[model samples]
Target: MVNKPVLPLSPIPKKWEKPLRGTVKINFDAAVSKTKTGFGVIARDSEGFVIGGGYGFKNEEMTGDWAKLYAFEESLKIARLLNITKVTFETDCAKHQ
Candidate 1:
């Protein structure tokens, strides 16, 4: 008899967190498909109001890691444009880490 190995499970958050006062929270994500890669970033204030956001697509093929990195970089650019000094960046790509 052969025993099957159990795969590790990732925890899902039940609730979302808001940033501290006078601060902003940025969330970024990326998706890779056979045709193209899509990336986006959104910035929200402490009250959960969206301050700014941007998204783009790459027609060229790319690895998942590269796509995720591009999403993070875009988030930083958006944050800078908003003039937000204090920020908390979050991403849902557990596999990237």
Candidate 2:
């Protein structure tokens, strides 16, 4: 049996925007609540298997937009580094389109 890998979405560095071509899609999403903020990313293969999933949070923020943006941007970078996985993103914050 082969061990599957997991990409923990935390400490998203400043660099994750650079694109890399591969056989995978990335999905990302962010949710903003009155008390806290949440953002996560999931990677799937062509067959739709959950290769890996991760999410980080920023608590006690007055503005959801900042948290959402930071989370989204960081998530993207994290996704790019992990190769051979389809990346997809989802977010409760719709304004971040």
Candidate 3:
């Protein structure tokens, strides 16, 4: 019998889509580490132009799920501050238990 080596599978790349006219899209992401957590949010218009963006880091530790939620909350705050009425949110965080 012969043994075969196994290779790790790679994730498929996804393309970003623009939002509809008269609306803005916000993409958010989070990073968690042993010492701190960080998040970023970017807002773009239908024309694919950057309207606003924000990023921040905290000195506390947290789980990936919590960090993702924090990123979402920050995105909402940015949208509100910009007086955006029609908005779409995007996140790459997968649900985990």
Candidate 4:
């Protein structure tokens, strides 16, 4: 067997961004496994402080893409419930077709 050159590993640091003044940022994500789909949501203020957070589970199985879309919908519902008018929605899924 021939020896192969190893690549160096570098870590990239990620930071949470603050929303605009007087606005809240709502971030959401979803995960789909063999059995079910789960999602999480978080609301942050302009200072990057988390004001509210939520997690949900779906018993019915669905495709990963659908799950992501559903999670986004749920996040919006939560925001409405919270009476958050000015919000910046963030999601890992592609919003447009």
What's the TM-score of each model vs. the native? 0.81, 0.51, 0.86, 0.77
RMSD of each: 3.5, 14.9, 4.8, 6.1
lDDT for each residue of candidate 3 in 8-95, tens digit (9 for 90 to 100): 2465577889999999999999988999999999999999999999999999899988899899999999999999999999997355
Question: Residue by residue across 71-91, what tens digits does model 4's lDDT show?
Answer: 889889888888999999987
Please give the TM-score that candidate 1 achieves against the real structure: 0.81
Clash pairs, model 4 backbone: none
Considering lDDT, which of the candidate structures 3 and 4 is the better prediction for this target?
3
Indicate the worst ten consecutive residues by lDDT in candidate 4: 4-13
Cα deviation of 95, candidate 4, in Å: 12
Stretches of candidate 2 off by over 4 Å are 1-22, 62-64, 84-93
lDDT of each: 0.87, 0.61, 0.91, 0.83
Candidates sorted by TM-score, best first? 3, 1, 4, 2
- What TM-score quantifies how close candidate 3 is to the native fold? 0.86
Off by over 4 Å in 3: 1-8, 93-97
| Tens digit of per-residue lDDT, candidate 2, span 1-77 | 97544433463444223233444445676667888778787766555556666888777654656776777686677
State in Å the error of residue 49, model 1.
Answer: 0.5
Write down the TM-score for model 2. Answer: 0.51
What's the ranking of the predictions by lDDT, best on top?
3, 1, 4, 2
| Model 3 worst lDDT window (10 residues) | 3-12
